[model samples]
Target: MTYPPDPYQPPDPYRPSDPYRPLDPYQAVQPPPPDPTPSYPPPYTPTSPAPSSGSGYPPPPPYGGGPAYGPPPGYPPPAKSPFGPPGYGASYGPQNTSAMAIASLVCSIAGVVTCISAPVGVVLGHLAKRQIRETGEGGEGLATAGLWVGYILTVIGVVTALFYAAIFIWAIAEGTNVTTTF
Candidate 1:
């Protein structure tokens, strides 16, 4: 009886017994050895004389020194503005002014003009102040002025109302005759 075919047998006679053999026949051609000397041009050499040690400028630190300012060699210097200093345009933009601050000032001024509106002005001023504190808004001076004006007017209004009520109570208590005539 014939034995079972060997599973590990090579299919082709030309296949190598060694597993590491190159698959391509051209891979057997050896590459040329590396040249003893490099073919690139020589590095740049400065022609100018070195700065004198006695010069006022401090000597540059050795290579690998900490960070330095200005552009590195072979790079052009940064452009400068002719109008102003280095940071001329750094803060360019209109400053943001708070709307509540303006409203508070207007309300306070109106309260002073028309005493009846003192309470409204006081309320607006307080709200504006609170908002200003919560948000870093401008116009703090306006808000402060509004608060002062509104408070003063409110006090005056309260005092005047109390005085009128007291006078009416006193008049009635004095037993004055009351008559209605058309």
Candidate 2:
């Protein structure tokens, strides 16, 4: 059986007799009562002079007197801009397309219908690129696309022409009779 704590000797520091008791001696002491009267700072007062009954300065005008400073009466309002707001000025409107670039794209499309147009498309595309660099006109992408399509089609056309020419030359050399087949 556990024995009760010694009444005469001091309690052991490592193991307390009562676990709920506070460690600090001052924890159980009560605080002092507050004073009866509370203190506060003095009230504020402005130093500027008040307006007198007979002063020389006139009274301020009524609130709705147009604006303090702006355009005079009967003046026209600002004109609205078509491009954007009033500050943008004349740099608006649709940009001009490069004429040579449009021509290059058209010729490249025509090359699909006729093989002779491929070379013309290539020439026009090169001229368009030069003009676009100098004058800042639009359609640089159109010119580049036309050049690529024209080159690819031109290679195909040349190979097809060579193949047909070889077939005709071989038929002539083989001594085949041509009158009955037609």
Candidate 3:
């Protein structure tokens, strides 16, 4: 004996002739017939080389040997600069500081803190002043200040080191001359 169809059972796609088969909503709604005219762009055709202008100057060679006048087909336009078009005059004043002068000041300040870079500061200061004289950059006062600070610090460091060395030698000499008796 054949069993009756269950109400909750899903319809089978293979059994199309079944009396209880569910109708497909998509089958009734066929796709609209294709339009007679297509919306595609026109076919591309290569053009001949561009004629040079009558001004006597030769036309510039095409970039990458692709096109003679404009960019190759399907390419986007060139991007614009964020700073606007070229040929605009300075928007701000001359704020360019000398790199060597800045370095000299930094080294001098560091030497003041660590007590070792004083000589480097002096050398850089002299170089910075020479560069400023030639290039006419700013920061001349900073270079001079760095030079004075470095010189003073270097002399103090040397004198302090010598004074300590002399005291150490004196202590050693005194110790050797002393006699210890049991």
Candidate 4:
């Protein structure tokens, strides 16, 4: 009677063992030896005609005929970063102009044209100067110009009024001095 196959034996014990495997199953297998001299393809040989002896680079195409190397037609240029460049300190947007300063300038101009708002312009100009000093806003030139214009116009208005009053008084006195024939 045939005995049962041993559990430790390989499934196909009759088949030939692998040539690369170690004789002892427990031993570490060694890799195949490498070739002493590497084999590589033969050096490249150019088939095209030889380049000109002068500069090797080909000449550029005639102006306007070559391909353009910028943004496509109708497309806008790339947007610049608001935060400046790498490693450079950050750049900020424009500072805001003071509203009071603008108002002062407008009122002063109106006063010059209408001769009624000079005092208002002067008051706004002083306020604008104070606000600009505290808040660090722009438009200082506008405030100063308004102040000068307002001051000059106000003084001129006062002097002209006084002169007209004096003339009216002199006319009344001259009329009283003349006796009426009636």
lDDT of 2 by residue, 1-182 (tens): 34454443344554434677646754453444553444332222345344354464434445785666654444444566777755744556777888888888889889989888987988999999999999888899999988988888888889999999999899897766555664
lDDT of 4 by residue, 1-182 (tens): 33454443324543335746646766655554554553433232465444465454443434685357875544456779997776754347687899999888888878867888987999999999999999888899999998998898889888988999999999999999999887
The number of clashing residue pairs in each candidate reads: 0, 0, 0, 0
Q: By TM-score, who's the top model here?
A: 4
TM-score per prediction, in order, is 0.44, 0.48, 0.48, 0.51
Candidate 1: misplaced stretches above 4 Å? 1-92, 177-182
Residue 172 CA error for candidate 2 (Å)? 1.6
Native-to-model Cα distance after best TM-score fit, residue 67 in candidate 1, in Å:
28
- lDDT winner: 4
lDDT of 2 at 93: 71
Looking at model 2, the pairs that clash are none
**Over 4 Å off in model 2, which ranges?**
1-92, 176-182
Reference-based lDDT, residue 173, model 3 = 100
* lDDT of candidate 1 over 1-182, digit per residue (tens): 23443333324444554657846765553444555554434333456444468564445546865348875544456767887675754655665667776777788778767876666666777777788788766777777787788888889878988999999999997757767679
List runs of model 4 lying over 4 Å from the truth: 1-91
